[model samples]
Target: MAASSEEFSVNANEAIRISLVQPGPNNRLITKHEFHPKFTYPIVGEAEQIFGYKGLEVELLFAAHDLRPHLQCSYVKKFDTVGTTSALDLNKTFGNFLPPTAFQQGFESEVLDDSKAAEWTPPGVCVKKYTRGGENFEVWAGSLLDMPMRTLVDNIQIFIVFFIEGGQFINLEEVDWTLDRWRVYLTYQKASKTPTPNASPYLFVGYATTYRFYKFQKPPKDHIPISFPPTETITPNTLPSRVRISQFLITPPYQSSGHGSALYQAIYDQVMADPTVLELTVEDPSEEFDKLRDMNDFDNLEPQFKAINLKIDTSPFASMDRGRLKRVPTARLLPLDQLQAIRSKNKIAGRQFARMVEMYLLAQIP
Candidate 1:
């Protein structure tokens, strides 16, 4: 019986068919692509396996534009209980990951109604629109405090667990001030043929999120401290802030398609254009994202670096400093003040600026 039971087990990631679905002709849903989840341990269990089922397949579908979701669980057979063993409770297991609405009987109908997708322009303002490979794309961004943006993120939070290893959901009950720190950006493909014939052309591609944290500014050397009232309506935006790229995910189909670069540049452009933002930083980024950042950051700064003739001064004793001192101070070896001005002007974090310098120096070689 133990050996027989082994046949009923299935790997959670493999058994789940996750898709970004869109409407085809006549308002019929069609899968854009089917991809397996990168991680399911958060949704299922640490073991990431399901037992007491055969031919198990779980369908987790998201409406491409709005990310409204639908879940359908099906299997060929369930093992008979011997003592206490039985089929895995699919609903109870997935309920933790999906919104409660996904399990309701009529929930699937909400997504099947292609009318919503047709009329859906991405929520919030269209911050950017560009053409790539002859297809038009738009980037829409809004404060999460807004109901539409909040609702949109609530619908899509399930992707964080599927794609990011240790991703966790954002708490929805936070106060307004905390919610104001969050900004969500969604990327969509503008209608090529209408989303449905004669429908709005927006189609979901990928998204990123960001938040602002206080960036302390040091006062002048001769400045004196002054006390102020405890509460005088000092909003978070009033002070200098570091624009942090918190969560960035370009969906599977859009990855490696230059969409990542476009989205990243858009964020950087937005941050730099804002006078209140001190510098831009990223929360812990994945290996892939690090590469993306490095490539784009260099591209943005390279022209300025060349225009200013930025390069390392290899000659430490060119001014006879060896005879007067034990070592060359870093400030003298490189023009620190000038580099700081450039970095500040560009709103790049310090360490990122240093890395960009290295990349600049390497490019100067040969």
Candidate 2:
């Protein structure tokens, strides 16, 4: 009996063991795993009693990495009579009960020739493509207004809940396209030289969402406010000054493959190209995301900061004269103007810029 239960346990112990182990050299935690169900039983009564009549088979689909793993399950009930067996409708029976991330029934890979395959390309305009670890990937950027983008997101957004804790789906229909503030970035893995036949040439790997808002620019002191007449039209460019990344996700299969960094860098490059964008920021970044952002931003800003000779001034302590011994001028110790210039040029937010500056200064102190 114990052995039978063990077989039906879906190797829950193994999952726990793996979750306990440290991350690989890449420093990425393996947070998700797919499992196959090996046994079926009823909610009540013994297994044989349920098999004698109508019964439900519960399949545990995914195990999330945690102190004690949480499992996501799917159900399949016997639809036919006791003697006769028929095909089980996994979607019709268990669609709503299963996690949205587990619903991939309609997303079967569609085969297409080269010409027809181009249509499968993500909605946004192609940004760039590069190779990493011998794997080729492309980045695309487009506004939410694009019809293809809207359609694709409707299908892919379901996976957000699985990858992002506490993530919720957004209503595409209710979105006000006239605002033109939403943008999506998608990354796809390009097929290799010997690609599988009938398989999609480009496999969707990950996506990110960003919203642009007007940066508050102070009005000139001499400028006076004027109420415009109803007939007058204000053609404000509405230049986006602040762009905040709302959601960022890379599929479990593709995580730790450098796709996240690629997607982020592509978006950062786009922000830099826009003259109106004063800063790039994230909305409620998770711990993992914060680390990723810090690594990328530090790598990007270090060279520029070094080129300008940006460093902490400890010389104030060097000249410990009686008149200057009253108190340490913390603000005056650092080159504020140079730091501000670097911050502006890099488009990093104030708090984030300060943290990076502090790290750089501390490194110089030793």
Candidate 3:
């Protein structure tokens, strides 16, 4: 018999809150086709089951002062509506799909108190891995520190302890889009009580709303009106659903370190212990990412770690029922030389700005 594994939970004594938020105007929405809704598919089998049947497995690790580590993963979920097949009701269910670039608009933030300064809190903490509600969120270390290379491992420990101990996970709202899960806002308060409406007097560090998706064990009966089809009538297999990494990211300052590998290993071990998982899937394969495989990056991490693309959909499955499946495609990485050429093509300032945006958007190590 296998050893019984222990489940971990955050300290209840700590007030770290995880809540849901509403979507805002600045966010973008996009429609995806041929993907599955996550709620319909349960990852840890039935209630009390140790592992998930059809969802994602997330792990985190903390390493050196780097704050950001390279992230790696095999599959994640894709949620959106299709023309007819596996369709999800938009207005009735999910409000709208946001585009990737919608939140690119940077918002100014103000420190609530003097203690929030850099000396008290490290600046520009690199975001090596961030995933929540289908949004690939990322932040760079440069933004955390006025002067780069100022981050220290000790400071990160202090920050993490403070956040974990305090109810200030909301502070993450400053740079993270997923903070929307919690209806909490982290903004700078203006001194003037009669501040002009919508004026630029104070900074909007973070809003209290965000767009997101949720998977349910079963569609509620009462909530299902006659106009809408009942979810229970739909068989589990036929239930419009897809497996996804609802939230997956390598903890900052801990990426490339053994943390990513350790986290993946834990996930693999947990999944293998469960019997419900079918064949896992990973979308678009990237040559750059594949190189990581050659380095034994994930060896001993999982039982069967395979990498393929759309071409292999027809192949017979060995672990199809619980492991083998499909994946979304990965975006291609441009050559450094070519990227430099494009950056230098425009004015020096333009090039610099473009680089900043690129680094902010794509520098996620994982």
Say which candidate scores most in TM-score.
1
What C-alpha lDDT, on a 0 to 100 scale, does residue 203 get in candidate 2? 57
Poorly placed runs, candidate 1 (over 4 Å): 4-6, 80-86, 112-116, 175-179, 198-200, 224-235, 318-326
Per-residue CA lDDT of candidate 1, range 247-301, in tens? Answer: 8888887789889988999899899889998798988888888899999999988
The TM-score that candidate 3 achieves is 0.20
Residue 349, model 3: lDDT of 25
| Predicted structure with the largest lDDT when compared to the true one | 1
* C-alpha lDDT of all candidate models, in order: 0.80, 0.60, 0.25
Q: Show where candidate 2 strays beyond 4 Å.
A: 1-119, 193-198, 220-237, 317-330
Checking candidate 1 for backbone clashes, the offending pairs are none
| Alpha-carbon shift of residue 105 in model 1 (angstroms) | 2.3
For residues 310-349, what per-residue lDDT tens digits would candidate 2 score against the true structure? 8766777777987776597767677788888889988999
List, residue by residue over 1-366, the lDDT tens digit for candidate 3: 432222221122121111111112243211111111122112222232222111322221111112221111111442332233232222222111111221232211111111222222223332233343343322222212223222222122223222221212213315343222211111222223212222222211111111122222444866754475442231232233222211122322223544333333333333234343222212222342233322332232112112111112233444356443443222222234433443333111233334343443343335
Model 3 residue 194 lDDT score: 15
Give the candidate order by descending lDDT: 1, 2, 3
TM-score of 1: 0.90
Q: What is the full ranking by TM-score, best candidate first? A: 1, 2, 3
**TM of each candidate vs. truth:** 0.90, 0.67, 0.20
